[model samples]
Target: MKTKRFSLRTLLLTAVLTVVLTAGVLLGAAWLLLGRAGVSMAETMVLINTLFVGEHDIQTATDQALDSLITGLGDRWSYYMDADSYQQQIQRRSNSYVGIGVTVTYLEEGVLHIEAVTAGGPAETAGLQAGEEITAVDGTALTAENISEATSLIQGEEGTQVTLTVRGTDGTEREVTVTRSQIDESPAEGELLSDGTGLVTIRNFNSRCAEDAIAAVDSLVEQGAQRLVFDVRNNGGGYVSELTDLLDHLLPEGTIFRQRSNFGWETTVTSDAQCVELPMAVLVNGNTYSAAEFFAAQLQEMDWGVIVGEPTFGKGFSQQTFPLASGGAVNLSTARYFTGEGVSLIGTGLTLDQEVALTEEQAAALSAGTLDPSEDPQLQAAIELLRETEEPS
Candidate 1:
């Protein structure tokens, strides 16, 4: 899964540094119509253009202006994306993208580590595996400061091949050429463990995600797994409607969530009386965000499941991406959301039934899909709790 784009985090933490491509023109318009503040800004631009010691690009300056304009809003959820990035975001929403299909994390040394290799993706087909290092993209060796730039270089027009210098887990290094294709990633996966435990990993909440997750749950039940565990770790969230549908499938008739805007208006999403009521648990980590976090919070709030793992840094607002004529776009936080209990999850996050923090080695193994249940404290605890708690009478 190519997690994180410019985040499902609608892919979130990758910040967009550039802004409205037409800001240069917008600046002139602002200068013409506005009063003293606009004049001051225009004066600064003029001074920089004439007297600056170094090369001063007016386009870059205008981009900075628009970027700063959004930053001034003081909302971390709001961000700007250039044209290409915005387009990638749209593709990701449809559960597809043009890339080699690997999820990466930056090491402390500024190196890129491949945490996941999408099954059957270009990277996987090219022999890339999890727990390896993408030392370089093409000939540009990855460095700490160049992580973002390196990632950008890895993405290109579909069908173009990108050379990746990969370091295997055995410590041997080799260069692998992977064709960048349109990787259509599945949003969910399911497995029935030997213990009759159904594991449904909902990687995202995007297009058709609920349908897939529901299918997985049903398949697991057909396999005779009475208890279930839903994995939403590292999930960045997606469409609220999808989240609502999934919640409705698992939870009984009730309010799934509530959306409130700054304008004092509110909207509520409710579920019917029908639901899947198996003894359940939601597995999470710090990267579990937005709709994913809300999914866990709702389950915990309604006593539908036990929330296991670390608490999420709470977020109350939901964002919507607005595209610009210049091909760029801005993802703005449009409304604050609440759990079904009508409470904000903006502080310590959802109540944890059991907080299981994995050791460094364990975390790495889990990321690489090598962590066995015996070695996974979170999974073991969740399964144990499900078995001992018994189904609700």
Candidate 2:
């Protein structure tokens, strides 16, 4: 009697397994048929996941599939970020975080190059200089595929230490250990020049950038500044909302820019009643991009300022970040923005009223904060133009 009962139980389990297998096959076939009938990509993904087999984490698989789909679009500006990376991006735009502060760029040759080091940050305190190459983090090799992972390893709770192997421009390597700490970024910096010009250098349009710029201008005015010079050299740009707010303060009431979405929807952004009525000159370079480029273009179009330096790095499209259910996010280029003159700065950047290219030596000196304004041809040209306006005709 016991043997008969055991055989019956085995038969029941076999029948259940067979039914599951058959159901999976049917679901897969249905998915194929729906694809042929022109089903949406989202629906197709759901069908594929419903019939997936073998050992796998469903969430991870879904994330990978979504990443693949976005990659297939062939849009360089659109990308998917994991949960951790998404959070880090948010922190960066907010201009604060806990990490060894350094901005890095991953080269096509798989080298991790330090682009900029924050003043007074842990990276700067550890004697890590810009233009150096980072070879490894905590002894693990750095590669294009692992750059984000390496960054994650470098960041940790405050008071944690991260060891990095760095290579100098001359190929000498050294290991440096840096401690993580909270960083509050001051994006806009101001100074009153000797010639009574207010020099407001906007590093990027991060959070509170507009407020900082206003305060900077106000302080410089109180110090007897007769003119303003807005420098955005090497500024890669940040939040668009912040950019618009900055423009609202600097430009008179008029059309600022027009945004056209993928679905043919359009929206026009106009300046508010508030404005800064001051003689201004904007300084830009090859690295001035996105919102920075727009800032220059708007001033040039309105005849509000004289634009100097090299042509900007053109990038007119604006990306919107969509948060995923898995805590990750995707930044997709949702719209292409055009200037008030109905010109798009996508491939061809903004044309400067006066062009001045900085030599390599001068650029290095400028980065080191040792470039004399009298020796800086671009700045000198701007100062001369502003001073000319001050003279009686």
Candidate 3:
């Protein structure tokens, strides 16, 4: 057998072809098992852009891609916001904004309903009230699709005016022009009840929540409040640091909550030496969630307070916002938190010492400010509970 000697050039070509084939096979395997062997996000993005058929600018495409990526995580707490929405979120977290300071919700009736009006804000100053429906913004009809646009229309440079057509609960409609200005919302409000119980309603745990809470509690104490009722009914929750700080003022030196991340890293937030020693009760409802739920759970776990009202909203996951280079942001569910006693409030919320459910009619009447406290079984129950503690045993 005559062995044909291959030339150096042919051998080199054959070796190069072998190397290329091997690399292709490895890459194919990697692409098949991309979840195990992570693929580069940049590479995926390039592939997406090359194949996407929708009409999208680079920014919109990237934003949508990021949003879709987060949505794929299948966690409701994880979300993506565009630049404008991200800025609005930051403003909300800061408890300050240059808008009319009215939070609105789109109703099924194609009306923009004012959910809450910031105290001393342009909306409140303009006599806007919660539950009022906004029909139009500056002559433009506000639909569910364009409610966000209407919100943008309402917000402008300080000193600018935005006209809103509002319908009152009594079916009266009128147009009011409100001048936008900087509004600072207090995170907590407190007052001493007639029975010497301090009623502190925490709006949300923003950055200034702890400070506001301290001031409110101190003021209530100065007004001769002997006990406290923390009303976190509608509070959806905010920064974890703010919650921890507020807890430090209320709880003695102990672990407030424990956070466990996906990587198995655990963190325990502890209270400081300073604490508010008043006998307390926490008021909660279906809207009470996240840090608010954590607050009630911690207090109940420590035997510091009696929890009242219905079961909580049961949000145990903690979210973290990551700012993108495009000025947008992504909020991701980074961890799940538990009470100091190792109780998780994810789906099954904290059971209250007293469970009181408000009838739909009563709730509607309460929202309309027509339901008397005498008829509000939940509030009455809390007051009775606290007052019983006040009475001599």
lDDT score, residue 86, model 3? 92
Q: Candidates sorted by TM-score, descending order?
A: 3, 1, 2
Superposed Cα deviation of residue 154, candidate 2 (Å) = 1.3
- Per-residue lDDT of 345-379 in model 3, one digit per residue for the tens? 87889889899989987766544445565677887
Error of 2 at 281 (Å): 1.5
Query: Best candidate, lDDT-wise?
Result: 1
Q: Which run of 10 residues does model 1 get worst, by summed lDDT?
A: 10-19
> What is the number of residue pairs that collide in model 1?
5
lDDT of 2 by residue, 1-393 (tens): 344556877999999999999999987886787664334766666776798676878778777877886797888778998888899999889889999988887776556788778889999999998889898998987887777577788889999998999999899999999999999999898999887888998988989898998889888878888889998888888888888888887899999888899899988889987887778998999889889889988888998888899987689889999999899999998999998778898788988878998999888666655577778888878887877777564
Residue ranges of candidate 2 with Cα displaced over 4 Å: 1-60, 262-265, 272-274, 364-374
- Global fold similarity of model 3 (TM-score): 0.84
Q: Which stretches of candidate 3 lie over 4 Å from their true place?
A: 1-41, 47-55, 359-376, 390-393
Clashes per candidate, residues 3 or more apart or on different chains: 5, 0, 0
Model 2 lDDT, full chain set: 0.85
Question: Where is model 2 poorest over a 10-residue stretch in terms of lDDT?
Answer: 36-45
lDDT of 1 by residue, 1-393 (tens): 674434344323333213343676677777778767868876887788788898666666766676797888999889887776778788888998899988888886767889988878898899998889988888888888888666788899988999989898999999999999988888998999888889898888999899999999989988898799999987889999999999999999898899988788999999899888789999999989999999999998888899999878888899999988667889999999998879888987778899999998888877766778767889889999888899555
